[model samples]
Target: MTTLASVVSCLSDYDPNALPVAQAQAIMRDFVQPVSGVARVPVRSALDRVLAEDVLSSIDVPSHDNSAMDGFAFASAELASAAGEVSLRVIGTAYAGVAFDGAPTAGEAVRVMTGAVMPAGCDTVIPQEFTQGDANTVRFARDAVRAGDNRRLRGEDLARGSAALSAGRTLRPADIGLLASLGIAEVSVRRKLRVAFFSTGDELRSIGEPLDAGCVYDSNRYTLHAMLSRLGVELLDMGVVRDDPAALETAFRTAAENADAIITSGGVSVGEADFTKQMMAKLGDVTFWKIAMRPGRPMAFGRITSDGPNSQGAFLFGLPGNPVAVMVTFYHFVRGALLRMMGATDAGAPLVPAVSATPIRKRPGRTEYQRAIAALNDRGQLEVRLTGQQGSGVLRSMSEANCFVVLAHEQGHVNAGDTVQVLLFDGLV
Candidate 1:
């Protein structure tokens, strides 16, 4: 286990109060350990779950040579000896899931549908569109198709005992189809990660509750739920924990005991009067940080543990209270860390390049993620522009935008037509 102290001691410039965004990300990445447990699930049930082990094929995919499409299966030998256009007498029709009766001779052919097993001696197929004649007599130019064209050989997709899917893959819909193709009814996958989350503040209220003079409705939990759900982690919504030290500690303990990770919004900033910080300090190894990034400067990261014999433990992410900042920090930092915790091998998406449509003011020392709309212009050039006001509390901007225009830590002001990198909302999809 890598202790928090050990990890920090290695970094010469480690400053919790003014940590660089990338440095904070690196610390969390090094600290988290993937939870250990495997579940045997049906292929369909394994979608979005991480594979526990590499899946070896029990049998060859397709099992035999098959036609790639509706075509005339024939031996390619006579085509090479022919002078010009070639013709063959069709012996029989071959439909999908059914094989032709016997091998076609030197100049004979079989009308084969898509996925039909190729005849014993046929090594090539001429698509029906390329052939000129009807079923009884198939004719086409001699040069239309070459040897072994349009024929899918046995074990072409996956050979018996070969690896069909590697370990640590986050299964997708296509992966399920592939498993089904291999006749794999079940798979061993990492169990879904349980993430317990809540909002910590004295002035936050849930929906349907009467608004007090100083309190606003708590939208952080809802956003957190949606964001965490997208990662396929099972969520424990602990609702709003009061600013009291005892309540905060209880929430922290319960979350650590039951979940793989504890995500809380608010009460991590330096000026918050709540005992959340004190409770965190009394818990397991936790570190408070003011990351060098816009909107989401104040945050916390580490692990917390429960008390007594059970003594369950979980990684903790204390995000900022602002609605936009919560989402921004989650995407930039926590999302990747949680993926590592679940044993997923996917490294997420890369930021795409786009030309800025307008000038933007920026400084050199901090990274900024301005919610922006990116689209292709008339010349098919990608262009990005900010979504109205860029306030951290302005959740509407996040709603209206499609991507974040990421300005680097050392990047200065951006002028119109200057290129910038964008993190698209649909990159995962």
Candidate 2:
């Protein structure tokens, strides 16, 4: 129920005409809320899903004290009186799945494989490699081991009734293994977010369509599909809508009715064919119409209500028409917004530090995301250089680059060998 006006009024330097990247990010964080849907799924199928509730361990992890390695287990008290080397009579051997039937007596030792239950009276273990042993006896220096060396205690990994995983955690592969270790068959997780996206512009055509004098194939939708797929969202590709007002309105309404979010890649800029802006204003609350960022200056954010009776409205992200602009804007804004809506506790990836390989000119008033390639130099330090062209329409630059060189708003120019922030796209996008 938080209104955009209420969120904006509280900011001291609010400016819709030239919104700073940090301020826009803050507004997004304040306005969007997590989805409330939850479902139970098998632990194997819960990877990447946000946990709905905390999972507490029902039993001790190891269930009992066990041997951590192949060694000789015995009481450590006898070592205190040893002169130089301590030797003990070999009683029996314990395998991983088996345990010694009885405790070893004083001056006696038992051979134990890794993961074997420690004998009842045993308090220490000397690794097999550290001891000179035969079938009947074991010999080692008195100072070879401490009292509790090579001993794993019960519940050392996960104690009973303790939280194994917390709510809002996006399950990783290691988390899945942890769940399996705890014998968890299923887990409650947030349902996948339903997102409907499309591109706008009469000049843009689908792949199979014939190209006219001024038309080009719409690459924005395909890029959106690839990025959204990586996010694991249920995507509804609405195809390409024209620049006409009626078409734009129909697209917006349909997306609002069927999706939790709507992403349109055109008609946000102040151009002659920008009917999407008008439709957005008419449909719902347009939070901000401009941002002080290069390649993606004009954008739109709204909470559009559908005509359907039970509709709660979908969050709208009207990105720029240019291919590179769409990508940069989506990463900087839409990606985090969608993660918040999906109930993920992760704050996204951190910016990595790297040295700039070449001098670059930049203005001081706006943030810039320059596509670049980064690699470790001969000195074992990360160095980054920009791709050929950084124009908004140069989709080739984005495809050829491995990371983005992020220049801050107040940052003016970069000299050669200057330290800059980089965000790698390997697993992030």
lDDT of 1: 0.91
What is candidate 1's TM-score against the reference?
0.97
lDDT of 2 by residue, 1-429 (tens): 877889899998888998998888889888888988999999989998989999999999888899998999999886886878999999999888888899888889999999999998998999999999689999999889988999999999999999999998989999999999999999999999999999988898899999999999999999999999988899999999987888888888888888899998988777557577778989988864588888788888868887886577999898988999999999999999999999988878889999999998999999999999999999999999999889999999998999999999999999999999999997688
Q: Measured by TM-score, how close is model 2 to the native structure?
A: 0.95
Per-model lDDT: 0.91, 0.90
Total colliding residue pairs, candidate 1:
0
Q: Which structure among the candidates has the greatest TM-score?
A: 1
* Candidate 1 regions with alpha-carbon error over 4 angstroms: none
Model 2 scores a C-alpha lDDT of 0.90
